[model samples]
Target chain A: MTREHLRILLPVLSLAVLLAAVFYLQPRAMSYFGLNLLFNLAIPVALATIAQMMIIMVNDIDLSIGTFVSFCACVTATLVQDAPLLGYAVLLAAVLVYAGIGAVIHLRGLPAIVVTLGTSFVWGGLAILVLPSPGGASPDWLQSLMKSKPPLVPMAIIAATLIGVLTHLLIKRSSIGVVLQGVGGNERALERAGWSIVRLKALAYGLAGLFGVLAGMALVGLTTSADANIALRYTLLSIAGVILGGGEFTGGRVSPIGAVLGALTLTLAASFLSFLRLSPDWQIGAQGAILILVLAIRLLVTRREAN
Target chain B: MSHITTTTPNRAAGLRDLVQKPWIWAYLAAAAAFGATMVISGGQGAGSLFYAALTFAAFSAIVGVGQMFVITLGPGNVDLSIPASMTLAATLALKFMDSNPSLILPGLMVAIGVGMGCGLFNFALILLLRIPPIIATLSSSFLFQSLAIWSNRGIRVKPPEPLAEFTTGGAVFLPNVALVAILIALAAWVVLERAIVGRWILSIGQNLRAAQLSGVPVNLVRFGVYVASAVLAGVTGFLLASFSGGANLNMGTEYMLMSIAVVVIGGSSIAGGNSNVPGIWGAALFMFLIVSMLNSYGLGAGVRLILTGLIIVTVVAFASKKGYAA
Candidate 1:
């Protein structure tokens, strides 16, 4: 296979392998009801991964995405239900904050990792302030909307597919996408071509914020409640998803479809272990092992291609 | 006219330069934090508070020093495995000691050995596997944490009396742990400032290609730094377990963030090629003081969290911009 084809095939192959392994071990998991159960939690994770992909595309990382999503969930649960106007305003401001973060990082030439890590605490604290405890009911409409059952495919699968296609088109098939990718590939070259790097980065961060909010709202809709720390684990999960999806740290390379598939793979892996009656404590380690194994394979493939 | 222009500008510039030094900001912030603590506590309990803060700062500094070693390796180098290593060390030490006073030394050795093993794993992943340090360390942390959990099995053991004494006991007015921390910092200073190895590390951080061309063993030094960082983290974990009187699962989690924060606040460039061993102590103290002050004022966890985040971002943003090009 050509290198380009191999690059795309890796994530697809990995996902297929995982799915096959899980289905082989537990044949019942292939049923429609079983598939729905398995993929229910994958939606928010996939959305968060897409959000992270946007930031990583700009050669930046957002450590605050998890907490920012949680903050949005808090708003959705409390403010959006009681006072829709204020809730929408706060959520929009959160997106603006992300854009501002991008601007600061670019203008000041600060490291994105540390800046986002710092902002994570700010976002987490704000979430806590908004909802001190873990008991805020999501709006009834949101709950019902997320619960909609389609004919054949599960709602989660449909939503995830839509997200994948929409983002893929926006990022891989559009003119502005070229400029965004250019910002990561060679910032100096892009600047020489008279593009404002700051604006591009800010735009990327804004998109990340928008997706983060969606992920949060989707999570609340599924869970039917919100907590400040609800999506805290999504930070690492999304980073892993992006990497598993064939995204590199320094390059603008990312695939929305691959990310969604990666998210599903990870989610299934966790549930598969649980299905095998493995202890919860070991599940985290098992997940890490899976991530390392996949990355190791990818690394070998890339190294061979280079040679 | 020339003399007047030169003198006026030179004086102003000198003042600006002094104020611009990152260490000065750390100390100023430390002073401000302490003053606030004193004011809130009505100065009656300031002495005890200061001592307590010193003890806490000493622990943080020990961990921070290790983190600084890795950060000095250059941009994109970090050890997320410190917390895991620490937790593992605590568990191993407690289990080895088994509440027996005679086994303390052996337990300490075991802790150090575990740390060395962790360092080796990290080095292997980064060098042999060619994985990025961030993800490599992060994944290793998972392995370590799992190991810790598996071994701990919800068991908690009290440290031996002498080891506990080493952490809590003091001479005249200084706690033993704080003294140990100061000595560690002093040793670090000598190694980084007065040793040949220090120069090699600095050169490597400044420019890897130039350092390699100049006959510096870049890989070896980087390996050594990771090992040293792991060992130091292990030592800190051992002492912290003794100080806290037992070992717990989440004992080392806070160190992960605090260690990085202390390194940055110490005026060390996060991009690497700089060493500020002494500054780490001040920064550690400064961070501890700020947290303590917030706690003393009865601030909520949310507020404290926000302030901590703001402080770290502000310090790193300002400090990294100086004496270096972004």
Candidate 2:
């Protein structure tokens, strides 16, 4: 197989193996309810991973996405419940701010990681200011929408499939998608071709912000509440998921379906560990181990390709 | 040509060059923060405040120097595992020492060993697995943090009495921790300015492909830098645990950001290749004083965090612009 095909296939194959392992360990997990329990939280993770993918598409990374999602959750739980229009306006402004940050980063040639690192603090601070102790209630409609069960496949699977297809169409098939990825692949070539790098980067960050906001809302919908530090671990998790889905940190390589599957794999991995009675402390270590193992496999595959 | 002039003119040019240097901003900011704190307190407790700033800033400076070395290696090179390594080293060392005064030396050794292990693992992942340094360090940090939590379950362990006293005590009106950090900074300065290894680092950062072809021993230098960073973090964690009376699971959390902040604010190139030891100290002191000043003004944590983030962005923006101009 070509490298691209392998990249897409690896996540699917691993996810299948992981699913089989989970089913073997707990035969009950084969049921729709068990699947829901396994994959319900995976939606927000997938959303966040897709959001990070957008930033990576522009050869940048958003370290602030976790905190930004937390901030959005705070907005959703409190403001959206009490004042719908004002809350939405605030979220809209946040996406614009993200776009502006992208522009500033490009204009000044500042490191994206450093700049986003700074913004993480800003977002975390804002989240705290919005909801100091995490007691705000999610919107009723959101809660209902998230809790509703569909026929046969469960709501989680339906949502995942919808997200996978929509994002694939938007990011992989669209003309603008090609141009955006081109900016990451070869900035000089695109600039020489009269495409504006600044605009593309801004668009990429804005889309990331939009997805991050959606992820936060979905999380609050599931949990029915929000906290400042709720999604802090999502930053690392999203990056890992993207990589597991065959997304490179540079060169604009990404697969939306693979990313969604990657998120599901991670969620299932956590469930599998819990079923094995692993300590909570070791769960994080297992995450690191999984990342290493996947990367090692990729290394082996690449070496064989080279030979 | 300027050096060939008369000594007086040469000295004047030297002073002028120092003024124009980007590192000057950090010192000026530190001074301004100190001045602001003094004003806020109406001149009361000046010595105590200054001493506290120095003591706290020392930990940041210690870790900041190590981060400086890694960052100086090049873009996309950073040790995100510093905080985790610090926690793990301190936890393991304190557990091994078991608060026994006689085992203090052995405790220090354990901390350093843990640091070296973390660094070696980080490097192995980067080299053997071909993972990017950013992701490698980040993932490794999870393992370190988990090890720390698993080992002690977040229990706070006390240090030996003598060690604690030494860490917290001062000699000649200067904090003992500050003294150690200053000594480390001086050694780092010597290495970066006078050693061939430092030159290799700079050359590699400037252009990796060219440096590799020109025989820079890039991998060895990288190995040394990563190890040095982790070792420093280890030592800092040891002293920090002693000074604070115990080691806690969350003790190293803030330093992750603090280390990087001081490096950038201290006038080091965030893009790598250029750094200065003096800037690290100034920036460290500035960071502590800035927080203290904001606290004295009765600002909430939310406000303080927002302002801190904004100030960091502003400083980085200005530093990058200065880099372009120079």
Interface RMSD of each: 1.5, 1.1
lDDT of 1 at A304: 88
lDDT digits (tens) for residues A53-82 of candidate 1: 998898877778888899899989999888
What is candidate 2's local distance difference test score?
0.88
Residues B146-203 of candidate 2 have per-residue lDDT tens digits of 8998998867778999999999999755899999999999999889989999899888
Model 1 regions more than 4 Å off: B1-21
Clashing pairs in 1: none
* TM-score attained by model 1: 0.94
Model 1 chain A, TM-score vs. native:
0.96
In the range B1-326, model 1's lDDT, one tens digit per residue, is 00111334558777675566566667777878999988987887877877887799988999899998898888778898899999999899998998899998899898899999989998988898787787788778878888888889998999998888888878766788888899999888888989999899888889989999999999999999999999998988999999999888899977877888788777888778986786788788888898888898899988987887888789778777874552
RMSD (CA, angstroms), candidate 1: 4.3
Q: Highest TM-score among the candidates is held by which one?
A: 2
DockQ by candidate, in order: 0.58, 0.69
Q: For every candidate structure, what is the RMSD over all alpha carbons to the true structure, in angstroms?
A: 4.3, 2.9
